[model samples]
Target: MARRALLSEAWWQQATIIPDNEREIAKHYTLDRSDLELIMRQNKAANRLGLACVLATLRYPGRPLADGEVLPAGVLRFLARQIGAPWESLQYYPLRDFWRDGKQMISA
Candidate 1:
């Protein structure tokens, strides 16, 4: 969510900031624990969704559509290919799980 990826920054730049040229990077860029946490959560969610799409495709072979459902584009094709389904029948879009009807909200 937050662009806090600073592999270029120094590990010991904090103590030597401003006055010390060695820690000059710390002045230019700031990274904290919360930034790291956001990155981690985003990575986890992405990995989980990717895995879920794969599993869904595997569960339903040949037919990319679950029932009367239609998938958008990108992710669908990827998952379909992952599970040996027809890419043409696949769709990729954002989906949200709804508890009320056990349904998914697919975006167009």
Candidate 2:
């Protein structure tokens, strides 16, 4: 028989378990000046917020964000407030190449 996976599917989907509490959210998801500069370089509001989420995922959960992954609401609110975008305006974020591209660029 094949060996069972050690980590849960949720671990593959980083940012899946980010805490929703205000202090924990701020601790893990706050965008710093460099992060803000990078996020601001993205073309549009949605892209900025999307990139921020990806960056946070890479930093905390230390893995690539899975497609269609839903981030914790507190994390979203923290990033959105920093990027000055509405938290509900991530219309262009879902499963988009923008996220993968940003992930690649950031990793590079």
Candidate 3:
């Protein structure tokens, strides 16, 4: 299994301001864009990957689904649509849970 890594202190620097730096990030992960960017500025490319890692970890479920089949919802689907991919589909699948978690479903 691919282990989820934590975001390094540097990711705060490189993170683009999305919604607000406070409500969107700090309230949850206790770290914000500034914090992440600072870490990135102090580190290198490999360290930047921590941005995605930390975000994913911070966004990790409050609890694993009892059925283990909880899929992305409508909002996420719409976002995915914007990111159109040949394999994209309306079906739901956690990034890590296609075959192991449930049936594979795709959307476009």
Candidate 4:
């Protein structure tokens, strides 16, 4: 099983601004505009996770993601499965720390 990774408050803060950074994040991920629109239309959870993936990728471009700097692969996989997306499409970090000491939904 893949280990669980935690997202830092700083990363969460950055993710919260996804609406304002949509274009940039999408561009960085090479996401097609139509596909982005489709994801947005899926549901709130899917939209959030999709945006989170894009933001995470933009935050950590290369390999060896920094501590608490990337979303857990398990979390990404779960979200992708929930939204009917392929898990292999996203590049997220593996488990490391717990988000908010396990209070966060993503950590559960």
Candidate with maximal lDDT: 2
Report backbone clashes per prediction: 4, 0, 17, 3
Q: List model 1 lDDT by residue over 15-72, tens digit each.
A: 3222223243233223335533443352234343344343443433322334554434
Candidate 3 worst ten-residue window by lDDT: 78-87
lDDT of 4 by residue, 1-108 (tens): 996659888986665442224345344444455645655663345344556465445544533334555455554554465455666644322221223333643652
Question: Model 2, which residues run further than 4 Å from truth?
Answer: 1-16, 95-108
- For each candidate, the alpha-carbon lDDT, in order, equals 0.38, 0.78, 0.36, 0.49
**What are the runs in model 1 whose C-alpha is more than 4 Å off?**
1-43, 62-108
Q: Could you give me the TM-score of model 3 versus the true structure?
A: 0.22
RMSD of 4: 14.4
lDDT of 2: 0.78
lDDT by residue (7-72, candidate 2, tens digit) is 888865553466778888888888779989898988778889889988998888776656667888
Locate the minimum summed-lDDT window of 10 residues in model 1.
91-100
Please report the TM-score between candidate 4 and the true structure.
Answer: 0.27
Better candidate by TM-score, 3 or 4 = 4
lDDT of 3 by residue, 22-68 (tens): 34433434435565555356233323333333343335433222343
Give lDDT for model 3: 0.36
The C-alpha TM-scores of every prediction are 0.21, 0.69, 0.22, 0.27
- Better-scoring candidate (TM-score), 1 or 3: 3
- The residue ranges of model 3 lying beyond 4 angstroms of the native Cα positions read 1-32, 62-108
Q: What does the lDDT come to for candidate 1?
A: 0.38
